[model samples]
Target chain A: MAWFGRHGDGAEHRPRGRGREPQRVERVGLDDLTPDPIAVLGQAAYLQLGHFEALSRAASTAPTLEAKGSLSAAAGKVLAKHSAIIAELDSRGADSSAAMSVHTAAIDRYFEMVQGADWYEDLASIYFTSGLLDDFFGRITGNLDGGAKISASISSDAGSEDIVQLLADGMSKDPRLASRLAVWGRRLVGDTLLMARSALPHPVNPPAGEARIEPVLTELMADHTRRMDRLGLTA
Target chain B: MAWFGRHGDGAEHRPRGRGREPQRVERVGLDDLTPDPIAVLGQAAYLQLGHFEALSRAASTAPTLEAKGSLSAAAGKVLAKHSAIIAELDSRGADSSAAMSVHTAAIDRYFEMVQGADWYEDLASIYFTSGLLDDFFGRITGNLDGGAKISASISSDAGSEDIVQLLADGMSKDPRLASRLAVWGRRLVGDTLLMARSALPHPVNPPAGEARIEPVLTELMADHTRRMDRLGLTA
Candidate 1:
């Protein structure tokens, strides 16, 4: 593995370490690091500001009653697909791991929130709607499919029935139609981008200002660019 | 099982189903049924207002340094716990369901936003903290655990592993802790109650003044009371 060291100004460089493998070094303080903190903070702040604003706007302006209904239907379809996979996994008597647990925990949180007292108009309509876009984006951008693999790994049998597997099965019945879903997915992403742009320039950025997230923002931009190139889309 | 039904107004009762058996309704509409919209709306509005206000307060007055550390530690611990469970489940070869799949989709959305925006602000913190609450509520509420007892019908272990069996094995390592956990289940309920009071109210209420959750709230309260009494906590 290639290891880079931080120079005096925080720029990455080839640093000599003990033998072939480098002994890890820790920078004690922010000042001790070499990168410009202000620039880093600014980039981070802008990204968050943009994202939160986008989410707020997208959620707020969702198509209202029909939006919830349509989204719910899509959710149900998705669930059916996943349930089939889970049942198969159960039948196979396979093993699970930390990653599966993370997925489970993430899912558990979503369901609980949806069923909670606080689940409201905005979330049902906007948060979820825009969120669907983000989901598709991550999937397409990441260029992978694990739904089938996850399904095959677990038991969808009586012992381990999962909603995701159910949805996946349902979707597979008319898998070709799954491509039609791209229209809705595109709309969701568009809304999210709009919201992000609107929310980016607020007077006070949340969590921390831009400085806290510069590295992350930089990475995201790079990823976005890569994704765009892969998809033959203009960045 | 007991069934309750009413006309447009709260006072009128209509018996539409079978004479002895409780009727199973597929779904209930919130807006059309409520007699007093203002009260319901007020509750929703209150929740939204509180969440935003909390976000603001956290942004201005909360200790950023401590929050940063605690949030990271708490998230890590939560992730670790979930990972271990997933690992155990995977080892047994279980598949998740369609409902779980939908839930996972929602979770993936939140995760993307958090990671993409690298939000350290109040928004990210709120999402992270509240996610734990979701997990707690989901487990106790029977959403994930209560789907179906179809697993009991399985005659063979052709493609299945028993999660309970896995749990039992781990518990065998610390038999004393198992009993303690069973007993301490009451404390989890108590702690859940405390956290509910502190954090749940935010999501409960929203901006639109459309509080579409009185029945669920009442049911939750009643269930919690029953559990408390069963635990012999009643004075």
Candidate 2:
């Protein structure tokens, strides 16, 4: 609850920026951003690499062949995307190695915390955890000047339709999976938020007078809820 | 031993075909081949899929980041190559699923016998097992009419330079690794031949009058020895 408590004051001022007309606000390019966007994006890439590693582990241990193949294919795409992001960061002269090292422990701990007990749990974890991270990155990239390509690449590289179908088929085979995954989904959101609090910098944790963090968190939660609903799970 | 025993009579007649002209082969097209080249290719694809699965498991359990990344990348390429082979097999109306099942137990047992003790062992196993298979496939494809593309793909996809560098780097860091990997490499060739004898048809276990099996095995052993020499290991 540190995340919620930290943003309590900012939550009250969320409506202040909404009333301003879009044209009245100054456009902020990548250089004008308060915190370095490249660093943030680089960290995101590194975290994704960790997710790829975890997904690889899950895919290998998956009980069913269908799940195994689907997960493996997904891991390949994630690795490709991670490689692209690292290359792009290198081109921009960003210290991607530093970025990767800084967030490695936090993201790794997040994986340790949510490691699944069985195939169903593993599938649900991969689906929800990756889906939420993609949503978060998608939202953050929308506010940046030079991050559109990276954002699009990450979005495109997210799990394929085959993965979605695999999960659906799994649930259909065992109706009880619906309820189990519903609970698993909630746990995924909680752990994801905790990971964000630890792994990410501001605007995840804003300065005293800044209120941007609350709305971002709100939007992310809203998107997560919708995703859970689509999966026939309660958020 | 079973493999050697099966070809004992053939071993005695190995010198019979050495003086034949290179142009005497009569250049048979894909359609003229006995036992259906597509069936052979399909079975190879199925076996490669099994290797991909084993590589994934090894990667997940590997002890070092370098080993894990190298193995995972190799697994990805293997999976992609397997997919391409499956697609081609489908186009040729070959039953890839049946081909896959035919040699499943043999290939699976081979994997079971050589599963690694740690990251170093896994890397050596992957490097040597895959290297031998690629060599074997390359030789077999040379005799086939339409196997060039598949052969090239498998060879190109075998192991990247990154893997070789990874092994070399590991050995440089710990000089004793050369001796350990040398022993591991010999085990790999032995286990690979055992699997081949159990799974492959024909020349590997030729009839009494056909002595071609010895020369082929001899050539394979020579190639493997040269590879070991290249790696600074004894044959």
Candidate 3:
């Protein structure tokens, strides 16, 4: 079983961004290590943007008007969340474009690696993968240098109910979707968790940093399971 | 010169939709013929939806944050217009999805044929193609069976000011962009005008029908030139 962060992609060693990098380490809660604020904003902003791009494309191929409508609306919400984070970066007087772009290459690489084979798997990927990434964000929202305010703004953007309903509707029509999507959901976790891992403080000391990331990965998987269960998929 | 409508792909012979074919020459004005109301809503709705799809994808590859924002906002507007048309279809008690899906294959084929070679060309494609279409609809707005209200709705959706500004910004940055985009703009007209052609009646009688389409295509060409001029591109 491949563990959370490393999938033999050597992603841990990859430079997330040029010049602006994740913090070495920041102490927040007793055992909770908050990542660099810039890193958080960059990844959060670009991740939602990535999902917006994916969902919008998915809408074009969506077989039914109902599915198309659901996908478009969901794409809008994710885009709104992305804009909120960019707004946060702007408020801090940062070069919002630079901040967001720094993470673009990394995020793009992640999406390229995880494209779904079919429409159902695509939705499942966004559902489970975004669920884990959002859950991970919520975990690290500790005093992010007023970046927590953006997190608060983002909290209201929670729960892609439209997506969940669409998926559940799919299951009701075709019973076999359950097992097939369950497998797809499991396959998504490793890459998603790696994305979450990259958003954290750069592991200056790999062994210790890898150890510190354990609890966060476990919670992300747990949240991922709950999200899958809601869709009647066995996570 | 391959005149408007016949690039010889046998498109005039294509069955646009299975059951809801365009009305066979509805005599509206003295010289003008309005297509089927179902056909109008189908093509109009799907065309905007297609723009939203292209712009949304284009935004991902946009090189700058400003360009991304512009593309995304343009996408949102095009999406709004598409939804408004669907709402109009519903108000008439027509099956909106079926109406839209009818034109999906033809419209998809058009986009596939006219894809831009670069970013500027892509924006130009959306700008010039959508301009000519909206202008063509405006020309035929003579008592379109309550469809004119949607036309009025779409009229306000006119003039992608942001896209014009984006292309204009590009020209100011690079002196050579004007001519390069102009060449791309010319390449697009043949296919776009053909798409405009496909939206009309199936041309039961070709010679007379082609003769009837002349003045309208002339006006469409004039409007296409004006749209090209807006981007500083020669038609």
Candidate 4:
């Protein structure tokens, strides 16, 4: 759904005195200040989910005792920063049992596998990197324009033209692989939509007063379609 | 335990020209290069457990479509990488069921929390960062001379120095909060050690094979102790 390069502080060139929140630069939820609240909300939900994936993987597999300790400390800091999002979602009174159960089962299996004598380094690298990519993608997917803007910001030195070319080259080298990945990507979309539907069916309280979700949802869908078109993904 | 300043990478710079398998730049499992087979076994077991955690989280929580679609892809990658270690450990015919069950439960709990609104973002950041740190610590803990090397390296970089300062400052500014986080860190360590103890009572086999494990473990333990000393913690 989204794409962007990593955001290092010195890399962004957003002119001095822009007065934009610096934290927002590294971890921007959406790229633009679009007026469509629905699309913005959808995008927010999606990106939050993506970031969650990144955070969890990063914290759980710390290799050395020292590194693990440092990361645990980082985790505490990150949690403090993002507590608002959690509280907002919780205020919604969503039903998260099914998703939580499935997620937990998978982690258990991983713990079992790695704890065994069969673990290896190369596989560890692959698992770790690929997971990282997924999490980043989740963060930027809802609004392609915003994602592109952020991606450009992240790789301000090379910018989107270069990054997109890199992606294109990578994809071109393995067209079959890209196709396979696309199919998989579609499946994830489906799964996410299903989850969203599940969340919707529950009569959760709005973070603000009034359960005025449908209008917001409609606007979000429109923005998603707009983003898909921008990314040349919509047929 | 160790910190990497900008200068650290320069000192031990080994150009990857040809005919060198990275020269064991890291001291992994053993206390010394002289070798002590028993400790190697323990370290190897610990590494595998780390792998399992990475794989499970990547498979379940990775937001990317490709990563999520064929969970087997991640599984296959892990199996291939750890095949040797797996074989080595299996050869021992030890009972891993109890430990496996415990890990599975922990992972399950983690994933469940992730799926819920209560702790999604916090959990996500923790997971991904933890994976990166694991790789970093595993590789760097032993290549240096002593605690001075580690302190110099840790103090050299701005980011790491900031992190160290941030932790120290935070702990000092709010003792109650710092105590809570310290308690959390201790619990995580205890849980991990318990899992390792339960999973493999013996060596789990390193990628380098049985002959190489004891030395690696010895090195790892020494490095770990040094790092703990630097962090002002009891490991």
In candidate 1, what are the lDDT values of residues A1-235, reduced to their tens digit? Answer: 0001222212222144323322232232122222322222222222222222222232223333222222333322222323333333344453212112323333323333322122222232223332332332222212212333432221112111221233234346656423433332233343434322222232143333333233333443454344333323334
Fnat for every candidate: 0.00, 0.20, 0.52, 0.12
lDDT of 4 by residue, A87-180 (tens): 3334445322222333344333433332212111212212222233223323333334334433222212212132223334445665654444
Candidate 1 clash total?
78
Cα deviation in Å at residue B123, candidate 1? 15
> Candidate 4, which CAPRI tier?
incorrect
User: TM-score (0 to 1) of chain B, per candidate?
Assistant: 0.30, 0.77, 0.81, 0.29
Q: Per-residue lDDT tens digits of candidate 2, residues A116-145?
A: 777667767777777777666654554456
Candidate 1 lDDT over residue span B1-235, tens digit each: 0111222321212244434322321113222322222222222222222222223223223233233222322322222323333332343344312112323333334333323111222332333223333333332222213211211111112110221222244356656544543444333343334443332233322431123233333444465445334323331
TM-score evaluated only on chain B, model 3: 0.81
Residue A96 in model 1: lDDT: 19
Show model 1 residue runs off by greater than 4 Å.
Answer: A1-224, B1-62, B97-235
> Interface RMSD of the predictions, in order shown?
13.5, 3.2, 1.7, 11.4
Higher TM-score: candidate 3 or 4?
3
Q: On residues B9-94, what C-alpha lDDT tens digit does candidate 3 reach at each position?
A: 22333355534322332231222344777777878888887777888978878888778876776777677777788888888888
| DockQ of prediction 1 | 0.02
Candidate 3 Cα misplacement greater than 4 A, ranges: A1-38, A138-153, A156-162, A165-180, A202-216, B1-38, B138-149, B156-180, B197-215
